[model samples]
Target: MANLGLLIIRLVVGLTFVGHGAQKLFGWFGGTGVTKTGEWLESIGIKPGGTIWAICAGLFELVGGLLFSAGVLTPIGAALITIIMIDAIVSVHGRNGYWLTNNGFEYNFVLIAVVIGVALIGPGDYVLFYRP
Candidate 1:
């Protein structure tokens, strides 16, 4: 039952992150794709051009989400996701206060917490392979 619960969490969170990646990578699901996403990153002071940042972030979200959902290399995936969430907080949401309504870091913080929790808890019995 606990593994079942973990499976559910992994699927939902991982797929959601994948969707976010799609938005940045291919502009799917109402995403703006690389051009606009990059511009937004620059607007927010991420620097080094929007395209580069968008590519890196898109890859991170896509691959990390995949590994996370598959329960393979869970910690590595969590680390990738965690780093992006931290960047989201620092580069964007940190200034909005504490609520989504204000575009704040609450959601980012929750994601950070969730990924970190998964990193600590392990991917459980449903994983494709276990690390230890």
Candidate 2:
């Protein structure tokens, strides 16, 4: 039962993040793809070239989320997402402070913690990728 919950949570969150990444990286959801998004980030004075960082972030969120959801490479996927969230919290959210209501890092911080938890404890047995 606990495993089922974990698996469900992982899948939902993973797919959600993956969709967001797809929007940013591939313009699937009308998002400005990596190039434009990167340019925007550069315009805002973030580290690393806009395109590079955008690509890295997009891939991390997309690939990591998908893998985590699928129960494949669970550790690697969660770890990557955890690192990305940490980076976001420190670089982006931290600047806004830790208040979710105030559009701060609180939300991301919690998510990072969650990712770490998922990484440390693999997803539960309820999975679509397996039949056993």
Candidate 3:
């Protein structure tokens, strides 16, 4: 049952990240694609926020999400997610306070906590590969 709970968390969060990566990289799922996303990043003062950075962010999300969902290299997956979330908080959400209602860092903080908690807790029994 505990493993089941972990699996459920992994699937939901990981797949959601995969979708977000797809949106940024391929413009699928109503995403703005690399160019537009880059433009947005530039607008946000991410300096050199162009194709390269966009690709990097997309790969991090896609690959990290994949590893996380598959429960392979769980630590690395968690690290990647953590890095992205930290970047998000620093670059985008740290302002406007801690509430999501004001476009704050609330959601990103929760994600960070979740990934970190899962990392500390271990990916559990229902994983594709287990490394402790």
Give me the overall lDDT of model 3. 0.87
TM-score of 2: 0.89
The 10-residue segment with the lowest total lDDT in model 1: 123-132
**On a 0 to 1 TM-score scale, where does candidate 1 land against the true structure?**
0.92
Candidate 1, residues 21-130, lDDT tens digits: the string is 99999999999999999999988777878899998999899888988888988889988898888888888889889899999999989988888898799888998775
Candidate 2 overall lDDT versus native: 0.82
Please identify which of the two predictions, 1 or 2, would achieve the higher lDDT against the true structure.
1
Clashes of each: 1, 0, 0
User: What's the TM-score of every candidate structure?
Assistant: 0.92, 0.89, 0.94
Pick by lDDT: which candidate is best?
1
Q: What is the lDDT of residue 98 in candidate 3?
A: 96
What's the best-to-worst order under lDDT?
1, 3, 2
In candidate 1, position 12 carries an lDDT of: 90
Task: Locate the minimum summed-lDDT window of 10 residues in model 3.
Answer: 46-55
| lDDT (10s digit) by residue, model 3, range 80-113 | 8889888899988897789999999999999989
Query: Candidate 1: what lDDT?
Result: 0.89
Q: Where's the lowest-lDDT run of ten residues in candidate 2? A: 123-132
